[model samples]
Target: MMRLRFLRPPGARPEKEFLARCLQCGQCAQVCIFDCIKMRTGFNPFTSGTPEISPRDAPCHLCMRCSAICPSDALEDVSIEESKMGYAKLDRKLCHTWKGFIICRSCYERCPLKATAMVLEKGIYPAITDRCVGCGVCEHVCPEQAIVTIPTRFVT
Candidate 1:
């Protein structure tokens, strides 16, 4: 079975440190302008009520509000480039542009970091760059569902 993957709010520390510092106060959820942050809902005491972002439902806009309002410093105040929420991986096999079926720039046009995070290789195929902070905008805008955001916590 595939493990359920979800992103933490921007500027989230490493999983262990984030859990230790998190107050589970829901302040991050309350302050999210995009309503991207949701308190984890489950009976598991270890993870219940922790802030999580489901990028497909709603992607982080990188406004930095949630991190700024986190009183426990569980979510650090960091710039958009430093957020490190996750990184986007594009599947060339499923991508419309890469497959040569159509020129789809949806992911590239919607990416907050545009040109920097998701670039148009050969001015056509969308390519993820090393600068990607994994804000999930690319995954959210992908019409072909060719993009996936691998959460930073899981990557480490």
Candidate 2:
């Protein structure tokens, strides 16, 4: 079955491997300061209670508290720079700046990584860079809904 483009907590391992390793404990959700992490609900035995993030509801703050409390190695205690949660992709067709109409800097302004992850190409259109950890802040903050955060598991 095809899984949705679900964003996992930062430092999560590969999707398949993570589902196998994660104990479905709510530890990560309990430790999150921003309350961005939520235990998966419903009756999915493979991943029920596993921590996930829905940027649309609330974006991750890169606090790393969840990883510190995770008992399973599914979430690694890694630096925010290496968290590799996901990557932001810009949809030029929907981007106001890319359309050459608005001077919107919403995505760039909200990106936690700032200049390193999201930057204005030619001092105008916002472009997603390799440094992006895909925290989904850009996706969450984009006024035009032009930015999408792709989970690391799908990046490869």
The number of the candidate with the highest lDDT is 1
Residues 37-128, model 1: lDDT tens digits: 99998777888889999889899999999999999999999889999998999999999999998998999999999889988888898999
Go through the candidates in order and give the C-alpha RMSD of each one to the true structure.
1.9, 2.3
lDDT of each: 0.90, 0.85
After superposition, candidate 1 runs with Cα above 4 Å error: 1-3, 154-156
Task: Give residue 13's lDDT in candidate 2 (0 to 100).
Answer: 84
- Model 2 has an lDDT value of 0.85
TM-score of candidate 1 versus the correct structure, residues matched by position: 0.96
Once superposed on the true structure, which residue ranges of model 2 sit more than 4 Å away at CA?
1-3, 154-156
lDDT of 2 by residue, 1-156 (tens): 323667999988888888888988788899898888888887877777888898877899899988888887888889999999888889999999999898999888877889998888999889988999989998888888888888887553
Q: What TM-score against the true fold does each predicted structure earn?
A: 0.96, 0.92
Error of 1 at 67 (Å): 0.5
